[model samples]
Target: MAENLPAGWSINGNGAEKSWFRRFEFPEYARLRRFLDGLAELAEATGVHPDNIGFGKDYANVSLTVPSSEEEQARLGDFVSRLDRLFEEN
Candidate 1:
């Protein structure tokens, strides 16, 4: 099943070669940490892993760079949507 993304999620950075960025605010760092591992797993399961994650005390800075290939872009979109929904549940 495809996950739903939250409103106002925007694309940042320039060019497909550069990493993509999204900012999300969660309840707390502990909860965020717990969920991120699961989220990373999902990314791997789908074969579209995030490049790096910056965890703040209460927020997350996610950066992903899927290849320009159509399949990778699709998978990347799916990953971001899932993350958007996961945030809602937490």
Candidate 2:
């Protein structure tokens, strides 16, 4: 299941059923802020919230969960794909 996640994301074995985690690094706080803001907007628009989102001066972490249903899995995949795109854009 972890094999198919986006480039930098990985499954969190310590988490409940369907959890994925990813951390990103930025050159500065401004860039990190932009990434986090965009990610928050994306999550809100999709009606899915990551379980955790941590940000520092130069890095950020996000954890996402989707229940084990087919529809939820599809939604998760789409969400991650959009996330990856957003990462590239910013």
Candidate 3:
């Protein structure tokens, strides 16, 4: 499942406890805030939310559950790609 992760993402745990994680960094607080806002909107739009989200003044740590099925893995990949795009845009 780790192989399915997008660039800059890592896998944690194993089996049912497996998850994908990424840390996004921003040059400033305002950009970080904007990225977080975009993340919230993405979750709302996709009906998929991160299992854990931690943030500071210039960074956010996001963790998302890794589903076992291929279909779900594809969905997760798309979500992750969008997250990467959000980071780039912000």
**TM-score-superior candidate, 1 or 3:** 3
Best of the two (1, 2) by lDDT: 2
Error of 2 at 18 (Å): 3.9
Off by over 4 Å in 1: 1-6
Q: Over the stretch 1-90, how does candidate 2's per-residue lDDT look in tens digits? A: 444776888877543555788888887788888888898899889987888888879988888875667788788888888888887888
Clashing pairs in 3: none
User: What does the lDDT come to for candidate 3?
Assistant: 0.88
Off by over 4 Å in 3: none
Task: Identify the candidate with maximal lDDT.
Answer: 3
Give the per-residue lDDT digits (tens) of candidate 3, residues 1-90.
336558899988988998999999888898998899999999999888999999988889999999888988888888899999999877
Question: Candidate 2: deviation at residue 48, Å?
Answer: 1.2
List TM-scores for all candidates, in order: 0.75, 0.87, 0.93
lDDT score of model 1?
0.71
Best candidate (score: TM-score): 3
Model 1 steric clash total: 0
